[model samples]
Target: MRELRGPIGVAIALWAVVATLFHLYTAGFGFYEPRSQRSLHLLFLLPLAFVLYPAGASSPKDRPSVLDWGLAALAVAANYYSYAQAFRINLRFENVTPLLWPEIVFGVVATLLVLEALRRAVTPVLAGLLALGILYLFATEYMPGMLNYRDMSFSEIVETMYLLNGMGMYGSITGISATMVAIFIAFGAFVTGSGTGRLFHNLGTRIAGRQSGGPGKVSVISSALFGTISGSSTANVFTTGSFTIPAMMRAGFRPHFAGGVETSSSVGGQIMPPVMGAGAFVMAEITNTPYSSIIVAALLGSLLYFFMILVSVHLEAKRLGLVGCDPSEIPPWREVLKDIHLLAPIFLLLVLLMMGRSPHFAAFWSIVAVLVVSWISPRTRLTPRKLWDVLVQAGNNMVIVALACAGASMLVACLTVTGVVISVSTLVATLADGSILIAGILLMATTLILGMGVPTTAAYIIGASIGAPILIQMGVPVLSAHLFVFYFAILADATPPVSVASYAAASIARSDPMRTGLAAFRLALAGFVVGYSYLYTPALTLQGPVLEIVGQVLVNVLGLVIIAAGLFGYLRSPLPMPLRMLLVPVGLFLTLFEAYSVWLRIPVELAVLAGLAYWPTLLSTPAPVRGETTRRAESAPD
Candidate 1:
C-alpha cells in the first residue's frame, strides 16, 4: 500500500471517506435501484484500488505513477458509464439486444479493470479462476460426458458478465458487497476505532489470566472476541497474536505451539456468530436464507469449535506442566469491566439481527451505538480526526472484499451461462454413487484445495458456486451444504503449505513457519470432523427436534474432549500411546455416526471416554520423560 503526500494523499482520503459515507447513508435510509447502487459502489472503490494497490512489487510505493493514473482514469470511466446506464441496461433484455458500440467498449473496459484491480488488491487466484472460467466457455464444446455444455459466443459472454444486472460485476454478489457487507465492514472499523480490540484483550487477560495454560487460553478468548469485528483471519492473527503469542511463549509454551494456538483461534473467529467475515453474507445471499437464520444455525458449531481449541490448550498445558502468569502482573477484573460498555454496539447489532431487521439496517445502527458508547468513557472516545480515519480505513479495508465480490461475480456468470455448475454437480453426484458421505468427502477436498491461498470470502464463493450444488444434488440441505463449504474454506487458513493465518502467527512467535502450520492444522482437526458431522445430521446445526439437538450437543462435547486428549496426549494424566491412539477413532465414531439414538449414545460414549481419560491416574504416577527440564526453556526474543 502507498503513502502518498501533497494533494494526491488528501484527494485519495476524500474518495475513501465518500465511499464509506455512501454505504452508511444507503444503509440507514434506503438503497437505490440494484444496478445503480452496485455500479456506484464499484465507481467509488475500484478507482481507489488502482491508486492504493501497486501493480507489482517494483511499482511505485509512495505515489501513483503514470500507469496508475491511467488505470485509475480507465476505472473511473468504465464504472461511471455503468452507473449512468444502469437503469436503461436493466430495462433491456440482456443478450437479446445487439450491443451498442459504446456499451461494448465500456463493458469490456469494466471487466478488464475489475479483474486487474482484483489481481492487485487480492491474490491472483481469483483472477486466474476467471481466466479459466472464460476458457471453459470456449472449451465446453470439447468436454466429455457430463462436463459438456453448449458453446457460448464471445459477445454473449461479455454481455452476461458485464451488462446483465444479475450476473456480472453488477450481480447479486456485488450487491451484497455494496450493501450488507460494506455496512458491516464500516461497523468493524467504528468498533475498532472505539478501542474495542484493546478491551477484548484486557478482558480476556483478566478473565483467563489465572487458569492453567492461562496465556494460551487468553489467545483463544481474545482472538475470538476480536475476530468478531476484524473479519479477516490474517488481520485477526496479527492484531491479537502480536500480544497473545508472546505471552504464551513467556508463560512456557513452545514457540510453534504458541503460534498454532493463536492461528487456530483466529481462524475460528471467521466462523464466529453475528459477523462471520464476508463469507456468511455471501452464503446468506447464495442460499437465499435469512442472515439471522444462518448465524443461528452456525452458533452451535462455532461454540464447539472454540471448545475443542480450549480443551487442547488445557491438555497441552497440563502435559507440559505450565502455570499461569503472576497474579500481580495481571489486571484486576474490576478495571477491565469498566470498559464493558465498549461491547454494547455488538450486543445491539445482535439484538437487531434477531429482531429480523435487514443486515445493513442492523449494522448502521450498531455503528451509531459505537460512536455514542465511545463517548461514555473518554479513554475510548472517537474524536473527529479518529472518525475521519475510521471512514477512510473502512473504505481501505473494504477494497479487497468489494473487488473480490466483483471478481467472483464474473466467474459465477461464466459458470451460470455455460451450465457447468449443474454439470459438475451431476458429475460429483455420480462419482459419489448415491453415497452422501462420499459426495461430502469429494467436495471437502475440492473446497480445501480451492481455499488455499485465497481469502475466506472468495474461497467460500468459489467453493459454494461449485461445491454446494454437488452436495445439494445428493440431498444435503441448502444451509448445511453452503456451511460445509464455509467451514473448510476457513480451515484452509491453517492447513499446511499455504496456511496464511498460521504463517502470520509464526512470524510473530519467531517459529518455523511449516511447523507452526502443522501445529495449527492439528489443533483445528476438530473443525473438520464437526463439518462432516453436520453434513450427516442437521441436528448439530440446531435443525432437528429439541431433544435431538440437545442430545447431539452433549454427545459431541464428550466426543471432542476425547479427541482433544488424544491429540494433545493428556487427560487426567499422561495417556499411554495405544490408549491415546485408540481414543481418536472411538471419539470420531461417536461424533460422526448419528444414526444411533442420541440419548443412548451420549451416556455410553461419555462413560467410555471419561474412563479412558481418567484410567492413567488410577494406575499410578507415570515417570517424567527425559529432557523435560530442557523442553521448558524461557522464550527467546525475535
Candidate 2:
C-alpha cells in the first residue's frame, strides 16, 4: 500500500512485472513440477507482500524500512530453499523421512513467513486460524477423546507445514493459486486495463438506466459483469458502487438502501458464471470436478440470487414511487454496443472452457485475446505503458490470493495431520441426526462466520475442508455439497454484523454500516434459500432432467418474487402489514413445496400467490406516498 518514489519502488515494480510474466508464460506453455511451481510462485509473491504492505501502523508509508527489506530477503531465501530442495522434498515420504537441521530451520521460517505475509496482505483472522492450527497440532495428544491425535514435534510439524509438497504451505491448494487462480487473475487484470470496465458501466447504464429502479439495477448489472473478472465482492463494490450508490442517492433512494443494493448485487457477482470468484476454482480443485461443470451447476442458483436482488430493488422502487433516469440522460444502445468487441476475449475464453481446455490454458489464451482486442480502438488500446500497468496490477492482486492460499494450506495441513477434519465432520454428522438439512445449517453457519473474517475463497477452502465431508457422508452429491459451502461463503459478505461488502458500500454511501448490512442481508435472503434448495433437490443445480430443471427453476423464481414482494411490502401495489406478514410464510411454504411433480405445483402455487397479491387491492384503496424523499426529488431534480 506504500507509494515509494525512488529506486526501491522501481525495483519492486520490475519484480512484479517479471512475476506476472512468469505466470503468463507458464500458463500458456506448461508448468514445472508441482513443488517447483508452487514454491517459485511464493518466491515471486511473498517478498512483494512485505514490501507493499506495512508491518504495522507506524511502518513507513513512502518506502519499506530495513526490517521490511530483511523480511523480503528472508522470504526469497526461504522459498529458494524450497525451490532448490523440491526434488529431494518430493522424493522423501512425508512424516516418514527424518528432516535435516537445515530443512527444519527453513521450513519453520517459510511457515512463519507465509503467516506473516497473510497477516499483512489479508485478515489476521485467517493468520490467527493458521497459528491456532499449529498450536493445536502441538497440543493434539493432550486433547480430549475424539479430539486427540499424536502430538507433532516442532521439526515434524515443520516438515508437514513447509517441507512437504502436498499438504502444507506448498500444497494442492497453493498449487491452485499458483496455476489456475494466478492465470485468471492476470486475465482479469488485462480485461480491466483494456477499457472493458468502462464498457461494462456504460452498457449497464444503457440497458438499465431507464428501467424501474434503474440506478440500483445498473449496480446489479455492472457489478455482476465486473464480478466475473474481478471476483472479489468488496472490490466490485468499490469499483461499481462508487458510481451507482451516488446515482441512487441522487435519485431519492435512502443511503442505507442504496448501500444495501450495491452490496447485495456486488456479492452476487461471485456466484455468476464463467469467471466466478477464485473460490470456484478452489472448489473445482478440491472436489475434482471440472471447472466448467461447477459453473454450469452454479448457473441457476446464481441467477436466482440476482433475480431476488433485482426484484427486491424493483418492488422497493415502486413502493417509494421512484423514477428512473431521464431518457435524455441514458445512452443509446448503439453507442454502448460500439465497444462490444471488448467482450470477445471473455466469449473466446468461454468457448475454450466448454471445449474442455484446462482453465489455465483457456485463461492464457484469453489474456492474448485481451491484448488483440485492446488494439481495436485507440481509446481502449493497451500500450507498452498500459501493459506494464496491467502486469503491475495483476502481480499486486495475486499477492493476497497466493498468500491466502498458502496460509490456508498451512491450516489444512494441521487439520489433516491432526485428524481434526474427520473428527469435526463426524461430530456434525452425529449432531445432525442423519438430517441433511440440519447438517447444512451447521455448515452454513460455520462458513458465514468464517467468511465474515477471511476472504471468501479461503473461507470456502476451510468450510469445504470441514463441512463438505459431512454433507458427502450424509449422501449429498459432491458438487451439491461444495456449492452449498461456496454459496454461504459468498453470502457472508452481505450478511449483517460483519458484512464486508455492505460495509464497503456503506463507506461510499455514508450510511450506517449496520443498517446497510441488514438491508443487504434482507435483499440477499434468496441466496440462502437457493443454497438450501439444492441440498434437497440437486436439480436446482441442473443435475436432473431438462424438464425437471425448468419446472423447478420456474417454481423457485416465483417463490423468490413472492418473497421479494412480501419483504418490500409491495406486489402490484403496496400491501397492508397483515397481508405482507401472511405472504412471507406463504411464499416460503410454496418454495418448499416439492411433493408432487413440479409441473403440477407451478400453476397452483402461481394462482395462490396471485390471489394473495391482488387480494390487498380488493380489500382497500392503496395509500399515496407523501414522504420527504418523493417531495425533495420532485422539487430538486438531478
All candidates: CA RMSD (Å): 6.8, 6.4
Top candidate (TM-score): 2
The count of backbone overlaps in candidate 2 is 0
Q: How many backbone clashes does every candidate have?
A: 0, 0
lDDT of 2 by residue, 1-638 (tens): 88867888888999999999999999988999999999899999999999999999999999998998999999999999889988888889777899988898888888888888888989899999999988888889999988799757888888888887778988999999999999999999999999887889889888888987788888888888999888889889998888889999988789999999999988988899889999999999888899999889999998898989989988999999998877876888787877899999999999999999999999999999999988988888999999999999899999999988888888888888788888898889899999987898899999999999999988999999999988887888999899999999999999978998998999999999999999999999999889988777889888878888888889889988888888899878777788778777877777865666777767867897777667856677667566966887789957
lDDT of 1 by residue, 272-355 (tens): 998988999998888888899998989999999999999999999999999887797578878787789998999999999999
Off by more than 4 A, model 2: 621-638
Give the runs in model 1 whose Cα sits over 4 Å from its true position: 142-147, 617-638
Residue range with the least summed lDDT across 10 consecutive positions in model 1? 629-638
Alpha-carbon lDDT, every model = 0.88, 0.89
User: Using Cα atoms with residue i matched to residue i, what is each candidate's TM-score against the true structure?
Assistant: 0.95, 0.95
Model 1 lDDT on a 0 to 1 scale = 0.88
